[model samples]
Target: MQSLLKNECSVLVFTLSGLNETMENRYVLFSLTALYYPLIVFCNVTIITTILLHKKLHEPMYVFICNLCVNGLFGTSGFYPKFLYDLLSHDHVISYIGCLIQIFVIYSSILCDFSTLTVMAFDRYVAICRPLEYHSIMTNQTILKCILYCWLAPFFSMCLVISLLSRLTLCGSTIEKLYCEIWAVAKLSCFSTIVNNVFGYIVTLTFFGHAVLIFCSYIYLIRKCRKSIESRQKFMQTCVPHLFSLINVTAAFMFDILYSRYGSKNMLQGVRNFMALEFLLVPPILNPLIYGLNLTIVRQQVMRLLFSRNKCDE
Candidate 1:
């Protein structure tokens, strides 16, 4: 029995059961995802390219927005290709290493979203609250450090999580969700996952604190802006989009976290699937649109680029 259990613990490939009941609609789903995934890619890519090519749009806020879009592409790439493949393939199995990489990419991207937003909020605060010090404080070096934090913090955090997950002896080989997630993988462990849970909560709380700080800072910004029309306009133009993106991402994360931790098994599979996929679906499409359309400079630059390309084709 002990040897058999040991053999079972050595799970090399994990079966993803998230698509089992939805297989009948595979072709329909595939068609939609095939159409939609590229749109997500294009939108994010356009924003990234627009920001990179135009020197005038290279401010701290635009740079952060560009980073957000890049992270969108990064996160969605981790899920969409595999998901599109699974929509057609009968087997929804992933190798152990592949699963770990997917988790790292997707979750780290999510964390990067929060980190970038935190820095963007700070940029706005300085630009509005202490206008004189804005350029000095948000120097090229500062922006680079902020970008590093956006990526490296999540990378190291997930490294610890994947390490913890790799150490566990998984008793099962099936994951219920559409993609590989830390919690889903951890739940398969044969032993108690108290440490993993603790560490996961620690990360969660730390980011939650970020959200809180951003909110508080924005409130102060709002109060300060009320006295000046220029500040008010800037807040509406820039901060509103950030607020919208924050709300969208926050809601998406909340849904996934709640569903993963406390979702009822009796719930419909479609509902479960949507809850799991909301973050991936909504944010990638939404973030780019929010920034590309809302920021006047980016919008003008994108339009100019499109016109120039068309003229070149002629």
Candidate 2:
């Protein structure tokens, strides 16, 4: 009891042990991250800028793509900057409050990805399935509401998580992950974390429900598009990118989930690190590339923007 009280009161910092075995290669890792992080920023920013600047691309689909890119930036920001810093530092530690903030930013951004994709699936459903009512149903105000739902829902969900986390009395101050994670921190709690665990499972089910919803919608879309070449082309042009992005994000999230729940100390740290970093590394860069390069109009507009900027420089 005395030790518990002392631990509970003294837990102010968390030592991150994920990098302990990989410090020998820190410089090489830091150099690569420095290069890769900027590339992610540039790609997402280019997609966002192209959508915002062109009046013709102001439709719901483009706007949602822009929101997606913005979210990619938001989510990656929660991890990459701090990760780069940690790679160079001898001590890998985070404050108690910092850990909570990291958990909120990282996890909320992930939930927001699901929310945005859910809204995008709905938009595609309306556009392809109910073509006549596409404009009417996806009015500017409605689009605004969808965007708000994407952001606000995740924000509130994570807020509740952070609130619950703050109430726990932690007996340990070491997290075994590269970044502060909610489950990792919760595992350190001195008492039962049944509430947090239940809530976490609920949140997981809700987001995976989003995936199921998107899959069902795509089934209907595939059936409807099969009847007409025009609709088929539309599906190929638009829905394919969204589908690819959904699959990529889903796979990455699954990797992290599996790693978090089943990863063992006996396993190699590099493989474990790869699993944890997959979502952060791939989805941010891949989302923009998938959308920008796959969508004709977005590709054309990006090229035109680059050419025009070059001409101005000349």
Candidate 3:
């Protein structure tokens, strides 16, 4: 009986040994991880600084941009270092507690991303549909309350999901993806994952569902803007940022769903590496550039900042 138990343990270990090895030689992964932080910091910092320095940008839209910059910075910094370390070391060895922390942070950040985008959509809705009442409706106190709600909603949601994930008894494999994703880790459990799947779908509905509503809201908003012929340029300007944000969010949700549902071994691994680049690198880099290059005020501020720095050096 003891010999049989020992054999079972040995087989389990042997079968799972190469799990992390499949992620090796991913230089693009390494480059992305290394490049992610500096770019995130630079873009987010520039955004926040540009907004703070210019009194003209203290409106609701820019306020939300500042909030987004802070959220993106936290998300990038919180997830990437540990993820990069895990990938390079080929160590799928995360403590159960560590795994829980990782899941909470990741899901919370994702929630923040989605919620902020939704709030930004509402801001556009008000700006386009109810321009006269925009100021009274989007007061500083109201915006602050929205921001607080955005953070809190995700905090509670992720806590519930993390609790459900923790109850799953991991038996088959310890090494999940390059990082600890709740769904991926839950699949390795010995027990049934019916509850996990159910709750996951519910969470997806609540979060991503809100995103869909926001998308529809934008569609209506654009139609309303078109009817208000006087502000056509202003309407398009307001929409460009939201349009980019919408595309990024949709791509992320689709990639995650596909990878979770139908992804095979090689495909899953490839998707994992590329998804980080797709979601993190592209949006952070593009958002600031879009706002900076397209908006005259932002472009002038950035150019002035650069010009001042060069003169100071001389």
Please give the CA lDDT of all the candidate structures.
0.92, 0.92, 0.72
Using TM-score as the yardstick, the better of models 1 and 3 is 1
Per-residue lDDT tens digits for candidate 2, residues 1-314, read 99888998898999999999999999999999999999999999999999999998999999999999999999888888989999999999998888888898888888888999999999999988899999999999999999999999999999999999999989899999899998898989989999999998899889989998999999999999999998999999999989988998888888887788777878899998899889898989999999899999999999999999999999
Worst 10 residues of 2 by lDDT: 256-265
RMSD of each: 1.1, 0.9, 4.0
Query: Which consecutive 10 residues in model 1 have the weakest lDDT in total?
Result: 1-10
Order of all candidates by lDDT, from best down to worst?
Answer: 1, 2, 3
lDDT by residue (tens digit), candidate 3, 231-313? 56776787777778767866876676677566666655555656633555566666677777777887788777778879999
TM-score of 3: 0.85
List ranges where model 3 is wrong by over 4 Å: 1-32, 87-92, 266-268
lDDT of 3 at 209: 82
Q: Which residue segments of model 2 deviate by more than 4 Å?
A: none
lDDT of 1 by residue, 1-314 (tens): 69647755578999999999999999999999999999999999999999999999889999999999999999999999999999989999999999999999999888888888999999999999999999999999999999999999988998998898888878888999999988999998888999999999998778777888899999999999999999999999999999899888888988888999999989999999999999999999999999999889999998998899899999
